[model samples]
Target: MSKTAELLKGAAEGFPDEVVTQATVRHLDLPGGAGRFALITLDNGFDHTKPTTFGPQSLTNLDAAIDQVAAEAEAGEIVGVGLTGKPFIFAVGADLKGVEVLKRREDALTIGIGGHEVFKRLSALPVPTFAYYNGAAMGGGVEVGLHCTYRTVSRSIAAFALPEVFLGLVPGWGGCTLLPNLIGADRAVTVIIENALNQNRMLSGPKVYELGIADAIFEAADFLEQSLVWTSAVLRGEIEVVRQDPDRGEAWDQAVARGRAIADEKVHGAAPAAYRALDIISQVRNGDLREGFAAEDQALADLIMGDELRSGLYAFNLVQRRAKRPVGAPDKSLARKVSKVGIVGAGLMASQLALLFVRRLEVPVVLTDIDQERVDKGVGWVHEQIDMQLLKGRINQDKANRLKAAVTGSLDKAEAFSDADFVIEAVFEEMGVKQQVFAELEAVVPEHAILATNTSSLSVTEMASKLKHPERVVGFHFFNPVAVLPLLEIVRAEQTDDASLATAFSVAKSLKKSAVLVKDAPAFVVNRILTRFMGAVLGAIDEGTPVEVADRALAPLGLPMSPVVLLDLVGPAVAHHVAGTLHKAFPDRFGTSENLGRVVEAGKRTLYVYDSGTPELDPEVAALFKVGDTVLTEEQVRARALEAIAEEIGLMLDEGVVAEAQDIDLCLITGAGWPFHLGGITPYLDREGISERVVGRRFLPVGTAGVPE
Candidate 1:
């Protein structure tokens, strides 16, 4: 009935870019035994078409608002409090940038500013509070939900977790302790730690409740009403509280004992942290819950803020947000859908994409190659997915049969792509090979069909130049494990038309993967940045930094994997090929390292001999680089590496390989393992003011630095 309540209602209705300050206030109706509750929402309401999480100040303010509701409820002025948001979502998480931006400011971990205090305050509120997780509840969002006594969720595609560890921070609030208490210690630790490394590992509502993390799940039809109704039950004590804590102490000791034994049987050894995290949980399983939580919090906090977590979190978050913009697309209203797609090669990349098209769009997909066996093998892979999905209960037998019937395999271009609405060729990297494939595909497919080439490093425009319908050809570069990696780089070229561009986005969207548009240039954007980083790593070894030491130094920088290991994963041959390609494109920028080529040509695994376990300060590498037994300092290696990478990123930005500074960061996060805590190039520049100095020197040779924009 208050003016603030009226304003709150209006805010809850939703407005773009407006932050919601307060959602609810509850008050008693005279002696009638009824109460009125005030509820509202805060959102940017961006056209992104999904619920956005809290972005800084929002979560800090939200904690205060909850306190006011709790005060009013405890004063006996209101019988209940409520929360509401539409189209399925409760707060999924706090604004990620808010937490990350701390590094930019001195002492970002200042007491109240720590933000975890908000979660603790929410959990300690006296009056019963319930969370309505209408949709995906992410890091901070899930932490806040777990703070409430009773949690309800709509039967929607929503998940819950304390995933902060993935972003270089732990579930600072009591989530680390509360989750284990609510669920079993073993399950909670395993789930928490995995998410600590990767945010996408999901723990959903129905399962969370079954594991005792959430209190209830509701059908979407009346989710909010049901949540309100549940709160009343909790307040009246109709629902009994259950506490399940199995002794984790001895159990953890036994686990470590088991892990040590298992380590002997395994290649990677006992996964020390895996056993340790669970062991600590067992140590305090039945102890004073909050006290145990505080202890656990310190333990997790110590590991969470380390260089490893920081680097990993930065890259992980960066990838999720930045790596997903379309490199090019037609205006939404003019977008076209491809009814049939063509794959020019029956190789792994093409075949993987072929399977996704059939599984995702349910459209006709054809695979063609030089031989029947190769084509059949590609088609067989799709069929294998058909049988697997049928067994997984994701699709019924009937749908699987339909999917199987929709795919085609052939050696003849006319039969494979004659009716293709879009044609994507994944062939040998040679220009002649790509041109020949496109020339034939252009003849076989209709003029309206979009011509797409899966070329990682070649010029898209040149490939299209050989085709009569050059306007239809574009680059569609997908990362390996097409089903897993969520990025699809759509390379825009000079000749690609509006219709074709629109079709590319349509295809990417249908595949449920994020699209990033990049111009067709040497190594494109992602590889350009990676080339610099990997080049620096190899260079450091030659410069006497020691190979493993240089590689390990970059690891704390938060790459997805070690640099040398990445070379192995990419295959020595391909690394050499890509490096050679870039080196040819820009001699100074991509200059080859003789030491790197040595390993590539010979296929040598171990680069340098170092102490046991640690890969740093290798004496053998010193011998190769002409250094004595004196150890190579980590600082020299790291600084040189950072300078080199910063320069390459600057070149891409200067050349407009990607149009924006953020796009450069996205490429690193998504394609390479650029850490996101730096926010992007701009933020990194802001963080390391000397980054400009580094960029200035690196770009000097490429005619980029000191040149007028």
Candidate 2:
């Protein structure tokens, strides 16, 4: 047999459970008498909820289907060949479960070579091949379309992307090579590198067409019908399909350089996938498809056997599976329906909450404050956001009107919250202020109504201590940019009942957030861990380390942003407040920096200014620091910072702040925006031996986040 057949037989010997995507073919009568065309539909025998994925058997099925279509094309039995997918999905890519089971580099190489051998057949066929992107398409799914002669897309497909680099792997099948050849190198860099690094950003259907990835765009209602007609026109010589030649000179070099800069900024050279992908894309300027394919095969084999990809797969599973079903959550049946929501403050956080509730729950959200002016401003902000969504086509005009009408402002708390089933306070962070707001709200809202606190570091139990209905209270902490961040830390207070916790989880689900059940401890999971981390860096700076050196120390760790940049985002005042709270709780481990306090007192929001699109230490902020005679190198600073993090996570586990180390990692990944290659910090700590060195044990077992023995 051939090499591809040999690899397929090997893969089947110990294949993991895979949802095989069957390529079923049927003869279609081309429109306008263009002649018979073979159309292959990719389906995994599941609903849209379960997207189709290619496994060894699935690729073999497609290979067989291609054989049938190739025979038909050669005999002139069909004018053309076309491929599409079942409702709302094309494919998501390779079944990662299959990749996880590979025991040797040869097995990994099989996946790469086998996929290329099968997909490239479309381009090699006698008749032209067309791809219809009916719905969501990702890594391998998008690459398969690149192998076709022409492609069409549905306008309503929500996600279309090549997200391989984001998962610590290059698009090994054909993506990195064919994409730049199809579109220009700059646009390919945007899809493969920039978008993937930016939290795996997805392209909308229109964006795909605009990027020239799709030849024709159609409405989802009749996408297949339109695509068939378009294909017929092309085959009958009635429509001239045109494509621009890709730039292979200075422009291609510049695009490759830009991709490298993005990868360095995002991963800081810690992960190898993006660089490997860039190398493949750069070499494709030579216009050798076979060379590009061989490079992809090598990159895939190397990455598949590496630890970063293993960690990435681990993180992906945590976010995709564990996040959906939170640990120690109450039964869904116990969750009370939140028909109406109430906000006790009308500030920015409260306004964001109002918008989120109204848009997701489709319930009336009332924002009540001390005065009508603040309430009106908050309501107006929500209305403006809805209009912006309408302008962006995320919502229609009627939906925007409904969302605007659903959010209202009121000065009377009793009148606004009497019928509200859920009331959350976004008032001041002070305990007394929150207690008073909850107390006032307790009197107005129904006794069964849930009370949530948007407290970042303060104790949820103490905030509800004086209230008569403390059992109804829960901590509903959300990260800033509420609509963007996916994490929701659901804090269960000392007196918080199961039903209250359940209702908070239910609300989080409706808001499309990943909720982690955290204990009502000081600062809780993400904040507690992050404050300790920042405290270490700040402490190093206080000892006379240069701010830039201390900031760049964590670059090797591949954090989402430097601690200094994160401080700017979190605000100096807020970071100081959280640090002080943690220091008060754990004096030796969490030390508040005098310089940070000075910066906050000076009202400096950021230590660096970006007038030239790059951060430079601000003169005013630099003058506030009082450094010691001692200094440390970046390596020492990184060591201290990581040790502090490992110790804090150990203490948190001991204190039962969260159910397990996984929850802590989940919070850091989703809430704190930690890199996935780190496996949310613990796995990184475990791999680097920091967890054992500092905490006396590994946070995760061997092979859990590293290559198996």
Candidate 3:
């Protein structure tokens, strides 16, 4: 046996069930005078829910299958080789579970080299080759198709991407070398870098063909038959496959520059994979295939043993596991059935709730307001959103019509809540207003009906105290732009019953969101942490730091958006409100800033406004602050912010806001857009020594962030 095969076999012996996919070979007769061909199908012996992924044994099986095809070709038994996947799935890529188990340098090197050696065999075969992309193909899955001579894709196939950089690794299995040379460097940078950074945006099969990646596209029902016929014609010289010559001029240089700029802006250069990917693509214009492959092998082995990859994998596992299984949720059987939903107001937030309930729950949702005009406006807004979805091809005509017909509005609270099993209020943030809405709802709603509030920072207990059945009240806080953000923070009040909490979790799951169970503390989890962090920033401004300097100081922390940008996106008025509420709840630790109050009073929307794409301090907003001689440097500003966050998080843990530190990490990662490589705030604190300095102890154990001993 070959050395690569031996290494893979030894590794597979340790985890026999880890490698999930197996390759099966079948002989097929071809048209157009081509005698016969050997077809290989990749399947994991599971339903489409478990997509095929490669591990040591999986790659070994594929390697042996390729060898059989090569032997058949040499014996004059086949004219070509065709590769495809089982129904509804191509492959996702390498098995991350397998990579997570590697602890030795030799094991990492063996896996990396084994993959390149096996996949490179596709190009070495002395026969015509084709890849039939039947469904989703990502990372190494897409790289395998690049090794083929031609390709055909299925109409039903979507979610095609090269997402290695997003996972904190480069495309190590020959993708870095082959993609840029096959498609021009400009297009390669987009597929490999820009799309990966944008949360791994994917392309449909037709889009794949339009990008010159596929030679033909066919319907899913007859995809294999069409691909076989096309391959036969190509072998018989009856059809031609045309490809665009890669552009290797100034265009390539400019594309590389653009890719670097995007990586720097998005990740602030914290991700090493982005720069390594750029390095690989830039070398492709002047390097040979073998040299590029060797470079990838080295890069993959190095990254697999790095702290960034370890932290990223930890974060990935947390999202995949903890987000699906909420920490303190009650049994699923305890959830009440929600047949109808009611909203207490007909404003923008209420209308957004209506759209979400009608679309996800597919049930009747009614909105109530004080007058007829506002009620009509809210209902009209819901219809407009449904129409927009129809126009964007997100929903069919039938779905759009059904969703639009399911929404209604009323001026009478009694009429809206008469039959609603779940009623939520998205009214003003004031406790008195929320109390009044819930009191009115309690008078009309059924005894079994749930009362929910979408308050960002108010106390759920106070809002429910005025209700006749406070046990039915639960906090269902959702972030703004409800359609995009995936987090649904479910707060359980002191009087909240298990039935109501279970139903809230069930509803969040049905909406396809990551649910986090939080205590009924002021601002709950995300807002409490965010408000404390923002307080430090505003405090620095109050101490005479430049508005721009204070805003730019957190860039090194690698937050998804800058503090200033986030404040603008979430309106100055909302931030100020939340800060004031948090300050009231925790007066000793959290403080409200006078400068932010001044800016809100001036009616300024943003502290810095864009002038020709450059952010300049809005003179009007800047004038709202009184400058003194107590300015701090960027390093000092960052230190102050980290210290504040550390202190607040320690208090949250002490108060048992959530179950564990992992819960806080999951909440921040999902709701607050904390970077994955940082492994949430606690891990970042542990690594930076800030947790020890401020709180006199580390937030996590040693080596939690894969810090070398």
Best by TM-score: 2
lDDT for each residue of candidate 2 in 334-442, tens digit (9 for 90 to 100): 9999999999899999999999999999999999998889998999999999999999878998989888989999999999999999999998888888888888888
Can you write out model 3's per-residue Cα lDDT over 134-220, one digit (the tens) per residue? Answer: 988998889888888888999888789988887778888877899888878888888889998776779899888888888999999
| Candidate 1 stretches greater than 4 Å from native | 1-18, 25-87, 95-132, 152-155, 218-241, 248-330, 540-546, 592-634, 678-686, 697-709
Using Cα atoms with residue i matched to residue i, what is each candidate's TM-score against the true structure? 0.76, 0.98, 0.96
Ranking by TM-score: 2, 3, 1
Q: Residue 565's C-alpha lDDT in candidate 1? A: 70
Candidate 2 lands at a TM-score of 0.98
Instruction: State how far residue 483 of model 3 sits from its true place (Å).
Output: 1.1
TM-score of 1: 0.76
Score candidate 1 by lDDT.
0.62
Quote the positional error of residue 229 for candidate 2 in Å: 1.5
Error of 3 at 341 (Å): 1.5
Candidates in order have lDDT scores of 0.62, 0.91, 0.86
lDDT of 1 by residue, 84-200 (tens): 444555665644433332322122333212345555555566655566677666665676667666676666544566665444445545555566666655566655665444534
- Give the root-mean-square deviation of each candidate in angstroms: 7.5, 1.4, 1.9
Q: Which pairs of residues collide in model 2?
A: none
- Model 3 stretches astray by more than 4 angstroms: 7-17, 701-709
